[model samples]
Target: MMTMHPQTPDILPRVAFVATGGTIAGTMTEDSKTSWAYSSAQRSGESLVMGIPGLLRRAQWHFEQPYSIGSQNLELGHMLQLRAVLLRLLESPEIDSIIVTHGTDTMEDMLYFLHLTVPSHALGKPVLFTGSMLPSDHEQADGPGNISGAFEFLIQCLSTNADVSGHSAMPFGLCMQGLFTPAHRVEKQSTAGLDAFDGPYSVLANTQWLLSRNALEMSEDSGVQGQFASLFDPTATRHPLFEAMEVPVVFCTPGNGPLRQLTDLLNRKPASVVVAAPGHGNIPEACVPVLRRLLLNGVSVVRASRVIAGGVEQGGEFDALDAFRQAPVQGGNAVFSEAGGLNLSKCVMYERLRVLAHSLSV
Candidate 1:
């Protein structure tokens, strides 16, 4: 007879893996080295999760595959679908946390869309998103490591009591960039870095978990579903209300054309115009006239800073205060301006104008 060793206790928290296919699920065919293909060989999300070295053994795991499409092929409708699924999960009490395996290509856009649509409170839970730069089938692929890192991050968040419960009034917390971050501030910093995302504000504290509070409160009475249905109609009209809507985007340089170029773009009768101005959303004295002209022409003119890492602060020389105090209010809506700087501002304006057009139609 032999003495038996004592069993070690399990300490990992239960995790739910939501696999939205990307390069992580892609494989390379031996014959065609030039082509990348997806294989059903490792099709199931659960099987993929179990294939990871220690994830399944460490935690009680669950899996759901909403779709197996590549990330590059993702569309706005797909994002809405993903949001619907996530909303359902957030409403459920059985799941402890969520991990979304996604492609890196459009991850930033997806993150921003989620941040804007989901309420701060629903964000209180530990929802981690991770993906690999390399395909899973490659010998030196980063997929396994990234997945392992995500699982480890979830374990750390739960074990440290950082994923707090019942804190439903605050924004949901997200762990990305091989660390934790808020969805709004999550952005990609490098094309091929393992730790690609950067959250400058440090919105996520290791001890804090996001609480889902004040989500856009879905209702049967609301016509949002009907509106969404209309979007799918092949005959639905898609048009921007203000024609030739264009924004002049320029980075900070000593002598980049301040306002002349912006005013010129506005002269084309763009419904709205955005200026990727210098630091703190400031424009040179020369550019103010261009802004004024656009406003006079009933063209919406917005100012966003050139800074990539921080928000444009108010109370600067080129701030909207002066425009607000002036009569006729030619300046456009500053609300359309975004903190992520020019590119994001463009996207925000595009979406805003799209909404405005829709409202006009109905």
Candidate 2:
């Protein structure tokens, strides 16, 4: 059930805490030192909020638990449902921002999905994602600290209207270890470490601890927002890709066997096929012929890199291929951004193609 926190003085900003249950809400084992072996979704959003010391006083807050499952079980349907809720919340005049507690495993993918599907016009408000590496009941549980830190970050942004890029609006972000990282740049690096997430390609919003020994430290203005508006039109009538009947992602390797494997994936008639190519989005020379055939047949084959940084550049083997030489291949460059680090562009491209395919069918 959803519940609203009492509004504070009119001067304070109102925030909505939407808990989608992750390790942050997980129960601790008897030993207390180990958090891996526990029941997820064991706690509610209200309970988690109350656990944060002095958090209720920081802002006017509301709580909702739309779904309480480990991120490993998250499906496309869940993302679609979340998007609907977010759209509704963003429309409210009372809510100033949103904080989502998610499981770490699929957090980045969810952020990417939301980054593409959420309407740009409604993105004026901030949406922050945070979760804990340890369970709530653990002695040094990081969930309360993370939530409090994120709350502080959001409160400060309430008066900020400037976008970091100065061109597009940045409506979404994540806070880890008190560092305000844009959503597209954040990547989970450790499974159990308290400070597990980091921004790969961008500078830290604030390197110093925001909340040390319960003392609050506000983040400095980075003058940057995740420029999501450039990815798609705010007025576009595209449906959520997760709602699509099928969206398969096929991985491509550099072996001679990749040609046959790639052919088999194309025969399935997927909405899109993303090749996890080697460095710089290079497909195996042997596999180029098969990719060309599929492209000729109107299949959307995106060339994505398996490496972590520096996105696929244009004019490579892909450019020399028959399909790309004649016309541009549906590569992963469209999703690349300075703030979008590595895997984000590829993830967004996969779902973007899926959404385009669904729009055509409808």
Candidate 3:
């Protein structure tokens, strides 16, 4: 091994590697590789980040954990705190880049939320998020490799976009198993695969790449989430909804079964409701009347499909009794996905931002 040349300390990128625990910080109670059998949030951020010096040899990693908890228990309050920490770190003169180890389950949600809320001033530095399918100590652990690859990704961004400027938002990507996907597109696909996330490298992704060399170069195409990138512009105003608003999800099931929940939700009268519709976001004929009543009662409704692939398209015709596709209601705040690209979780965040924007304008 040619381990001759030593790395210059000053040349290394200063990375604030924030660990908000997930399987990467997890440890199995018994001697097992089973992902579900493990306890998450067991390790500290320093313990998780310090091991990277041997693999990457590039960045000087600093450890910071906003808090330790599984993604399932992730709440809006935690994310507001995280947004605060990330904005502080990115704006800091000490740090040159950032790599966050977050739970894969709600990682995309946080990314999408941050994509909307993070100020443009903080977008200059490289921000990359990553986590693992297996625990840190597992024999076939992928956290080390994922972390190494993620660090390399930031280096590539710093190298490429050092002089690039004037864009409203800089590149932020999710790295898993060698695939680097943009914030707007990344989604968790598998529960058990070593490489558990996919976007540009997904099997169903439009373009194909070998994942062997150069994923960061492909990231330029994945940069800045077009129209969905900004809402509630931090520079313009500080609307309280950014941190406090809540959008509840309602799933449309077969027949009259969902009526009870819909009735309860109607009584709750939330700001917005994101419905997981059957087929292409189709509201069942039976529930149409109640949905109308909800809409008339000033509860906004946004439709998303339960199906994995194709999203709900607007202006699509529907037969009698069934509510139309992902279109805004006649006189309410139903937010439509400009394109048929939003999934259920995305629709939730999108609706939140839409409500925030609507509130800011008023």
Q: How accurate locally is residue 157 in candidate 3, as Cα lDDT from 0 to 100? A: 55
TM-score for each candidate, following the candidate numbering: 0.63, 0.75, 0.80
Ranking according to lDDT, highest score first: 3, 2, 1
lDDT for model 1, on a 0 to 1 scale? Answer: 0.55
Give the poorly placed runs of model 1, Cα more than 4 Å off: 1-14, 28-44, 57-60, 68-74, 159-163, 168-177, 198-272, 278-290, 296-299, 315-321, 324-362
In lDDT terms, which candidate is top? 3
Task: For model 3, state the Cα shift of residue 142 in Å.
Answer: 0.7
TM-score of 2: 0.75
lDDT of each: 0.55, 0.62, 0.66
| Top candidate by TM-score | 3
- Predicted candidate 1 versus true structure: per-residue lDDT over 1-362, tens digit per residue: 11111112644455678888876666666753666444422345676677787667777677887777777777666666677677666656666667888877777666655655554455545677776666677776777776776666665555555426544322333344445555544566777656666445333333333332223232221112123323322222223332233434534345646544664566476555555667777766666666666666655545566666454545556554354433345333322332333244324434443445544555
Residue clash pairs of candidate 2? 164-223, 164-224, 164-225
**What does the lDDT read for residue 315 in candidate 2?**
50
> What lDDT score is found at residue 111 in candidate 2?
76
TM-score of 3: 0.80
